[model samples]
Target: MTEITADRVGGDWLSAPRAQAVFAALADQGFAAYAVGGCVRNALLGAPVEDLDIATEARPEETVAAVEAAGLKAVPTGADHGTITVVSEGEGFEVTTFRADVETDGRHARVRFSKTLEEDARRRDFTINALYARPDGQVIAPLGAGQLEDLAARRVRFIGDAEARIREDYLRILRYFRFAAWYGDPEAGFDPEALAAIAAEGAGLTRLSKERVGAEMKKLLSAPDPAPALGAMAQSGALARVLPGAVSESLAPLIHLEGQAGSGPEPLRRLAALGVRADVDLRLSKAEQKHLARLWEAVDSGAGPAALGYRFGEALARDALLLRAAALGMPLDPEALSEATHGARQSFPVSARDLMPERQGAEIGAALAELEARWIASGFTLDRAALLANLRKK
Candidate 1:
């Protein structure tokens, strides 16, 4: 009975020619197709719809044949899992056959393709994500009793029993917090039942792959304000379960500092603010690991913002300053921020080449290091000639 206005669902992505073509192909083949999950949920919430996913009564092979018959390309991207990527006009849309979970073992699920939309909706994680919309913007009412209300209230609740849902996939424990951070209402607070279920299932988190946990953490940290959700995770014991010794207290201050500094969410920086060694629990890229290591190094070095900027560049310097300020519960220094910007643009005037001849081999590197320290200590005011004059004195 719930319906989204045509105007709301009529965004460019939904109405694009290619999208309509895919819908038409499924309709012509007499398979009931509806834009499902995040696409429908985000559209109704007036949030950005990143991907268009369609759930159909058509079997995977049938879905494939229908798209190809319509002169569109069908790639069996997840064919074994009842999904096919239907390509039209160079854009790909994930077209999946409706499924019902047959068996689940905390990490993976074996699903059976089902013809009923109700079955498909029931198997989804959250109530809000179970709503569906037709190509023409007619939204099929969610089968769950309070789902529509949950969506309107900005509440992210697991479908059916929370513990049952979590047991189906331990990763849902982290996903619960991630979704809460991104989509749930911070003021409303998280659902107590969900939090309790998560707490009871905390041990299941250890079974999830580090990469999956890392990806979820990155998304959670990238939210506009993740502090409230993170605090909830800590309370539910899920935070400690995933990241031992991680604390959420400093994150709020860091977020406030970021706002004052006009910096958007930086997941790695926020993760650093948590003050845990994530390199062990999370699978970070080499570049991310190095950047994280440098943030900690800069913090421990007791380096001024200017020095941090000079050594790590402006962006990192700002992160270090913000993290340091948050740790100390102090307001950011405006002058220090300006100095960071200034220092990032400064180039050291004392390279090894400048120390060559007078200083050779290992001595050249040693001399350059000494002079660069003096140059930076001088607030970078000493030019090449002024710095080289120190060598003459020595």
Candidate 2:
């Protein structure tokens, strides 16, 4: 088992002035405060921590007062839920008081403020995530004695009853698969109870808004080895119900292809690999949908550099080609990629203005475009004068 020391948890976020201030304020108010949840779990794993969350024993009102007194801006983002967003120097830290779930609807939880770390840990999802680190560098583990053991064991066991936890929030069903994809060990396989609970609550996922489901699903599919989770979803019949896509029979090669392509992380290509339609209103904006549509076209057309440059922008064309290579399970040929990128960057040999005497207006533009296409087809060998000559002949 991998043991996490206090030094392992020290990073930019934990050491930030704002975060220190919040800790100091809560300490001064006689409240126990600590960084908890994914932040702590990710810290131990050396993963990038995007958000810092602090759980305190102080009440919401007291927490706000202490934050304001510490010269920080506190917004009552979820006062009823004992949570607030505290801003310091333009960065936001989500501060939530220790709370226990009073009631749950398998989608939303009604939580009540608590004063003990144990109560707070009891309300969380997974054992690894429930571990906490105090400001004094002491780790507080309430879920079980061996939080690090469970994490290293590659287990996704719940803090308590898997069914009760899944009942608290159906999104946990998807989160289970997502977290597993990113962190679980493939050799260990999914826990049977966790899998069964996820399957049972999968249909409740339909109750979630498309925007929420879309976000989670996209993240899930973007993982380094999303195939396992996707395959599990397909086997459990979850993808067909929540997502508007076909769960492909073969996704392992596509996942491996994604790792090979190494392109920018646009979830659309991954989603498309799952046989999803980009233009569907899965809660994307008109502009976003249009861009996805263009991406789809560029990937599907199998167009060369010139064709892609005209259809999509030069950069997008390169991205489309890379994603296309991934989807097709073809190795990313460095020579081909380099040639395409260089070709996309090269300027056309001639423009319509150069054909002023022979061809005029839109026809001149059309002629020049055709000449450029020929020049590109000839591997950029045709000179400007030759392109103009070709245009004139046409």
Candidate 3:
């Protein structure tokens, strides 16, 4: 019976024509449907609603038939799991039948579609995500007695027993911290019982796929401020379980440096700040791995900011400088940072083509290399004419 005021939840998304049409179609079939999960939670919190999901009393095939009868396309996105993607006005809405877990193995769950909202709510990982909103904007909380309070307090508490929830799907271990970073109050801290549960089940993280682990880590690090969550993860031993040798000590300072530089969160940069070899543990894409490797090299090269920018481009140069500053426990130099941007903008001014014929073959490359060094040393102020003149002197 928890109520979210209409003003708080009212928006075009709440009454979108297509979403309303889907609800009408379900109602016509005497099947109840309500917007559920993240869509409802975010709408109540005044956050952007990215995806629209609905939970229904109808079975998966019943949902498909109802939508199809209404001239809407039904996609069996997860039909075996009671989820059907109903397409209306060219937008896809995930319509899932209410389900309860029948069995769990820490990685996968066998669920049975249920007839009641309470059963659906109880199977959810966190209370904040278990909320539902009728198409008319009536909010429903059928699980935790404190579900609404937890959402209002910005707490990410597991439904029922924390350990039991973790045992159901160990990925919830990482998800707990990820949600904390994005939604939980850092000052209020994490739920102690949840932390205890996570610490006890820390080893379950290894049972997850590397891609899933990497994805959760990236999302966690992308939060506006992830240091507090990371610190907690370290204390709970979850950080080491996924990324051995990773520490949270330097992350706060790196975040401070990023803010000072007016930069937004960059996962790989923060990951670099952790001083762990992500490639060894995370399933990062080839491009990401290569970029991370370059970042490490830049930090260790002792190269000046401008040189870094010239070599790695502006964005990566800034990341390297920030990582280097965080590692050294030094404040970032504004002048040095500006110089990096300047270097990224600057061309070599003297390519091998300029030196071709004047010095043929390997000698041309050697001469350009020497000239480029002198040019970089001159703060990139040395023009092509000056560099060529210096080459002539050699």
Of candidates 2 and 1, the better by lDDT: 1
Instruction: Specify the poorest-scoring 10-residue window by lDDT in model 1.
Output: 1-10
**Candidate 1, residues 1-394: lDDT per residue as tens digits?**
2343443365877888999999999999999899988887888878899999999999999998898999999999999999999999999999999999999999999999999999999899988889888898777765854777787778999998999999999999888888888888898999988998998888999999999999999999999999999999999998888788899999999999999999999999999889864496699999989989987887788888888889888988888899999999999988889999998999987677676677789998778888888888999999999888867887
Q: What is the lDDT of residue 142 in candidate 2?
A: 76
Candidate 2 structure quality by residue, lDDT tens digits, 214-277? 7787788778777787788777777777765676544666566545656544566667667676
For model 1, the stretches where C-alpha displacement exceeds 4 angstroms are: 1-8
Q: How do the predictions measure up, each by TM-score?
A: 0.96, 0.88, 0.96
Q: Against the unseen true structure, what C-alpha lDDT does each candidate score?
A: 0.88, 0.76, 0.90
By TM-score, how accurate is candidate 1? Answer: 0.96
* Pairs of residues clashing in candidate 2: none
At residue 209, give the lDDT of candidate 2. Answer: 73
* Prediction RMSDs, each to the true structure: 2.2, 2.8, 2.1
Give the candidates in order of lDDT, highest first.
3, 1, 2
Top of the candidates by lDDT: 3
lDDT by residue (tens digit), candidate 3, 1-394: 2343543355777698988999999999999998888888888888898988899999999998899999999999999999999999999999999999999999999999899999999999999999988888888888754888898788999999999999999999999999999888899999999999999988898899988999999999999999999999999999999988898889999999999999999999999888875486688999999989988888888889999899889998899899878888899999988999998998888888887676788898788789888989998889999888877875
